[model samples]
Target: MASRDLVTGKIFSLQTIVGILGNFSVLYFYLFLHYTRCKLRSTDCNLKNLTVANLLVIFSKGVPKMMAGFGLKDFINDFGCKFFFYVHRVGRDVSIGTTCLLSVFQAIAISPLNSRWAELKVKAHKYIATSNIFCWILNMMLNIILPLYVTDKRNNTNFTQKTDYGYCYVMEDGTVTMKIYAALILCRDGFSLVLIVSASSFTVFILHRHKQQVRYIHRNNLSPRSSPESTATQSILVLLCTFVSLWTLSSIFLICLTVLNNLSLWLRNTSALINACFPTVSPYILINYDSRVPRVCFA
Candidate 1:
């Protein structure tokens, strides 16, 4: 094996291990809360769904990359390639949608009574399940076309019309129809990103306003410590920042890979690493910010 491949394999192996453990920790903590009849917040549902989506991304994207890195590139057949690619695309889209949903809900939850979002605040929690279900359905439908375009690399002899994804071959002709389809996919992702940014901005404004109101209390030595609301707000803000940053980086890598007619193994490895970064790091953010997680762990 090449030295570069060995290094990539080790790195992916670590990411796969850490991401799985962290996400499962979050899932286990939430499941424990549920089985124990612990009081759950409305946002907990979103967190759980997000964790599941992260797991899906890790298993479908990260695991395959790891296997490829370890010289198992030819292990996957046409069916496996299609299945993994399809699941990864669906999982990634769902993750973005869930994050957007969570951000909007947080903004609504913090809205002032006289604000335009007040009405949403009262009914937001009620729609969490419905919203999550819709997100899954929408993404699944959107990415159903992936399987048709993906096949095992070993089985394909054509090099002029296919892009190698290490373990799978993506049939791309750069035709007008394919370009239009790609544009539509970009539009869908762009819409989700816009919503996320707007919701996050609104949440930041509300938090800032609340902080200003509470400044006087702290100044008067009334309440020296921060409120639980403040902590939760900080968590959401950090989560949004982390997601946006990683999402931007991953998108760049993905676009670079997609537009290139030839496959560069280095670019492919780097892209896979960037794509897995959010899932690997996000669970740690949640674990650190959520006060209840430690309690459940100790219990």
Candidate 2:
């Protein structure tokens, strides 16, 4: 049992390291490029925000796991515990908010002039800052209550052990509160998932239409490269597709673990690994997909 645990921990540690390094590299590349250029278009701003959010998650969550795997359990003291968990929660919330905003922006960018939502694009720049501020505040308020529930105290030796680890949490009064918490989490996740799906769907439809239009113009012997609109559109579509796929899988696993509660230890860990893997893999995808990055150099 000890050997098995050690091996599993080692594997998880390696995975976490990969994720952290990859995410950090992505963040640094973007920051370096932006500083050298001294300016970013609106799309670059969105991508930069996403990269920063992912970097925060890597620092708060991924790095800690690597330390813990190397027998640094005591390194994360009570203060570290609270601070790291808080940052991890906040970073994850920011990622969620940013992804939703990215989708909305893509939809607006692609909306036809005659569409009702077309008017929204005109005012989007004004609200971008405000929206991010609102998301931060809302998430902070929602999760401020988490510390009230969790604690660093170890479990009693004689208690029927469900989870091997200990953290802060209010004692379950009954199944009712657990159910409520589960339900609330599900609702929040579901809402985000819906937005992602809706936005991605709209963007795809718009892209299809735009492609048809381009083909039509080509048939009429019109030049297609007159505007760089197609390139930009394709980039946004890729971003949306990547965001939706990664987040949706993580959200689904979280929902299952929260609601089902009967999942085995291996299954739970597998779900967690999947959830963590996405954030780690996300940075590499951004780096590879961004046209500005030299592929061979990064490779």
Candidate 3:
């Protein structure tokens, strides 16, 4: 095994382990809250789904990349490749949709009574479960074709136009059908990006206004303790920013890989690393900001 493979394998191993632990902790914390009859927020459902989706992405993508990095060549069959890639793509897309939904929901949750979003604030919580179900269904349907393009690397050694992802190969036929599917995926992600950005911007504006009001009320000294709403808003903003930055980086690498047929091992691993960043980092971010976590831990 090359030194590069050894190094990447170690990195993936650490990342996957940490990500799994973090997400599971968050999921368990939320589940405990639910079963113990604790007061739950409307957006708790969204957080639960987000953690699950993040787990899917980490398991499906991170595990395979980890295995491949360990120099496990031709270990996966065509079916395995298809299944893993299909799950990864679905999970990836769903994560995006859920994150967007969470941001929009948070924005509405904080909207002023007279604002246009105020009406949505009343009904938004009721629709969160339905929205999550719809997100899963839509992303699954969109990514169902992904398996058709992926196959175990050893099986398609002769293909001239293929993206070798270490453990598996994505055979691109350069067909109009493939192009159309790519465009559709891009469009879906683009729409989600717009929603997330708009919602996040609204949240920042609200937070700014809130701070201004607090300052006006207590001009001598700022409030010693942040309000629950302010803390939640700040945390969600941080999470959203992290997601967007990492997603953008991963997308750039993905587009480059799509356009370039030749295998670039460094690029492939780097992309995988970037893609795993959010799932690995996001759970801890939530845990840090959620006050309930400390209580639950000590209880």
Q: All candidates: CA RMSD in angstroms? A: 1.4, 3.8, 1.5
Compared with the true structure, what per-residue lDDT tens digits does model 2 show for residues 182-286? 576567767877887798888889888878767877888777563545565666667667767777787777767655754665665566566566567766766
- For each candidate, the alpha-carbon lDDT, in order, equals 0.87, 0.65, 0.89
Candidate closer to the true structure by TM-score (higher is better), 1 or 2: 1
Residue runs of model 2 more than 4 Å from their true location after superposition = 37-39, 71-75, 153-162, 166-182, 216-229, 259-264, 295-299
Model 1 residue 254 CA deviation in Å: 2.3
Better of 2 and 3 by TM-score: 3
TM-score of each: 0.96, 0.80, 0.96
lDDT of 1 by residue, 152-237 (tens): 97773664588777788888766786777788789988888898899899888878888887788877878587676767778978
Candidate closest to the true structure, highest lDDT: 3
Worst 10 residues of 2 by lDDT: 161-170
- What is the TM-score of candidate 3? 0.96
Q: List the residue pairs that clash in candidate 2.
A: 149-169, 149-170, 150-168, 150-169, 151-168
Give the Å shift of residue 123 in candidate 2: 1.7
